[model samples]
Each structure stands twice: as C-alpha cells, then as structure tokens.
Target: MTTDGCVFCRIAARELDASVVLESATVLAFLDADPVTPGHVLVVPRAHLPTLADLDEDIAAEMFLVARSVAGALRQSSLRCDGVNLFYADG
Candidate 1:
C-alpha cells in the first residue's frame, strides 16, 4: 500500500538516498533522519501500508523481528546507556 510519492518507497527502489543499516527480502532498516537519540534507527517494511491493519500478519511479524534484532544490537552497541532519560523542549 505504498503511496504514489512516498519517501520510503523511493528508498526501497534506490531512486532516492538513505543510509540503510539492515535489509532483508521484505524489509529495510535505516538511521532516523531526525533522531531522538544518538543512534536512533528506523525499521520499516519494504511496503508502505501506513498502518498495521493494512499489513498482513507475516509482514507484521517480520517487522517486529527486525525491531528485536535492532534491540539486541543496541544492547551490545557502544551506544548502549545504563539508564534512559526523557525530556521535552516543546512549549
């Protein structure tokens, strides 16, 4: 369910640019262009459904699988932190 002009779709086709981290037959992972933390990443499906209800169970499972892998890597990564701190600058 990719949009006619979506950034993720372009990233998938290589028509646009992105710093991909992980990729599988059905998924791709890239660093967050606007990150909330030092090493924030984005794990998205090759398709652009926009919502989980629009995706099949298999795709959802794979998405979570990628997230799990990312989490594992983060745990052992040099970017790992002992505690997570949250703050907001919005007013």
Candidate 2:
C-alpha cells in the first residue's frame, strides 16, 4: 500500500522523476535531489512504510541489502569516497 502524498511512494510508482540507481521488486534506490554528499542516495521500500516499525522482516532485510550494494558501488566509483554511510530517516 502507499500513502496519498508520500514523496517516496510517488517515486516508487514512477509518478515522479528521480535519478534511479537501482530497482527491485520491493525496493528502489535513487540519487537524492538534495544530497548531503556528492554520491548520496536514498534506499526505500516500495510500500508506504512510515517508520522502521512498519517494515516487515523480509522488506527490511532487502532494503539493507540494496543499501549495502549501493554503498559498495559508490566506494568503487570515482567519487573519491573512502567509505559510505547509510542514513535512515523515518517519520
């Protein structure tokens, strides 16, 4: 399910434009419009989960796995980053 006005949901649904980096059945990873770092990306589940507590076990695991993969790719790229940081924001 998705929330009516949730931005992430819009992106996931292809209703909004995003620099999509990776996409799976349950998750979407994309470049942040307002990134904290040069290669900053956001990983989110397709469902409208408002908080961590709202995520199911399988979806949560998939989210982390996708994030890890993205992080690795960023480190290997010419972004000049020694490491990657994953940030979670829920509200």
Q: Evaluated with lDDT, which candidate comes out highest?
A: 2
lDDT of 1 by residue, 1-91 (tens): 4378877788888888888878888888787788888667777778776665776898778877876777677778898556433221121
Model 2: per-residue lDDT, tens digit, 14-86? Answer: 9999999998999999999998889999999998998999999999999999998998889889898977877
Report how far off residue 22 is in candidate 1 (Å): 0.9
- TM-score winner: 2
RMSD of each: 5.2, 1.2
Q: List the residue pairs that clash in candidate 1.
A: none
Instruction: TM-score each candidate.
Output: 0.80, 0.94
Worst 10 residues of 2 by lDDT: 82-91
Error of 2 at 11 (Å): 0.4
lDDT of 2: 0.91
| Candidate 1: regions farther than 4 A off | 83-91
Candidate 2 deviant stretches above 4 angstroms: none
